[model samples]
Target: MKLSNSTVLVTGGSSGLGGATVRALVEAGAKVVIADVNIAAGEALAAELGDAARFVPTDVTDEAAARTAVDAAVTLGGRIDGLINCAGIVVASKAVGRQGPHDLASFTRCIQINLIGSFNMIRLAAAAMQAQDANDAGERGVIINTASVAAYDGQIGQAAYAASKAGVVGMTLPLAREFAKTGIRVLTIAPGLFETPMMDDLPEAAREALGQMTPFPARLGKPQEFAALACHALGNTMLNGETIRLDGAIRLPPK
Candidate 1:
């Protein structure tokens, strides 16, 4: 869909990748809804963007909250034309560690937020978009989900994170097919070693070393790059049901 005047909902839009997407969409003339749990960041971003955006406090895993966010998106621009699932958490723990088996709670939490949370937003947004009239191309909306390269080249400590992201990649095609009848395309973007908050806690040297892992360019992926791809995916109706890896040709070692 054309970004101009289209309404899109972005989860985890308060910061990081989602924040970049929200900014880019606004710049492209799209009305955006920032759905995130971070109230301060969300409100501040919406304020900064003026009338082009709205901030809705949302926990993607909670159905009620997600629905509220959807409603807010519709209210912001009169209809929902796209949905970007960017809310996720990373968990690094071996299945069997020196202490013992990895913490089950942490694994479950990762899955709940990354996988289930994405689905929650998709379901609700699809329903809303379905109610709207389709364009000449019979396109009502587009949905983009965020996965991780860990799903494919998971390191030794990435069992939980990998599984959760893998689930995202696994669902793309099926969701695309199912939503085809409604003219709502589904796709996923699997990012690798991006400069996100997840890497913020690492030492500067550690972060630099991680950036060096990418084969080409030899640097961390930028949030703006991810946003550019997201906008491109939304506008290109032919791109659907595929998990496009935004990685810079780097495959993780066993570690």
Candidate 2:
């Protein structure tokens, strides 16, 4: 669907890839509901975008909160036309670490937030989008999920993170087929090392070294680039049920 005048709910919409998407959608003339746990930043972004955007404090993993956000999006825009699941967390504990063993709690948290949380938003939002009137082409809505290259080339100490993301990649086609009759599309974007807040925490030298792993560009990805591809996906109905990696030719080593 064309982004102009569409209503999209974006999880983790306060910052990083999500934040960039919000900006791009607003600029494209689509109304956006910024769903995020970071209320301060979310509210700020919503305010910056004025009537084109709204902020809904949300926990993607929370049934009640997620439902509320979907409802809010409908209330704000009359219907939910698109949903982007960007709320996620990462962990770096090995199966057997120096601490003796990986923390079960940590591993579970990674899955809960990244994998299960994404499914929660997808299911709920799909239900909401299902009830909407389809466009002339029988399109009800579109969903875009975020995964990572680590799901395939997981580096050292990425057991939890990799598994969670791999689950995301695994679910893409199945969910797409299940939602096919309903006219809602399911797709995932697996990004490589990008210049997000997480990367910002690293020293510049360290970050540059990581970027060099990607051929050509030889620099960290800009959030705008991610946003651009997401916009393209939203507008292209032919692209569905696949995980598109936005990595810059980077096959991470087992560092």
Best by lDDT: 1
lDDT of 1 by residue, 18-105 (tens): 9999999999999999999999999999999999999999999999999999999999889999999999998889899899999999
Q: Any residue pairs clashing in model 1, and if so which?
A: none
Model 2 local distance difference test score: 0.94
lDDT of each residue in 1-255, candidate 2, tens digit only: 989889999999999999999999999999999999999999999988999999999998899999999998899889999999888998987799777999999999999999999999999999999998998779999999999999999998999999999999999999999999999999999999898888877988999898888996888899999999999999999999999999988899988
Q: TM-score for each prediction?
A: 0.99, 0.99
Candidate 2 lDDT trough over 10 residues, lowest sum: 90-99
lDDT of 2 at 54: 95
Error of 2 at 120 (Å): 0.4
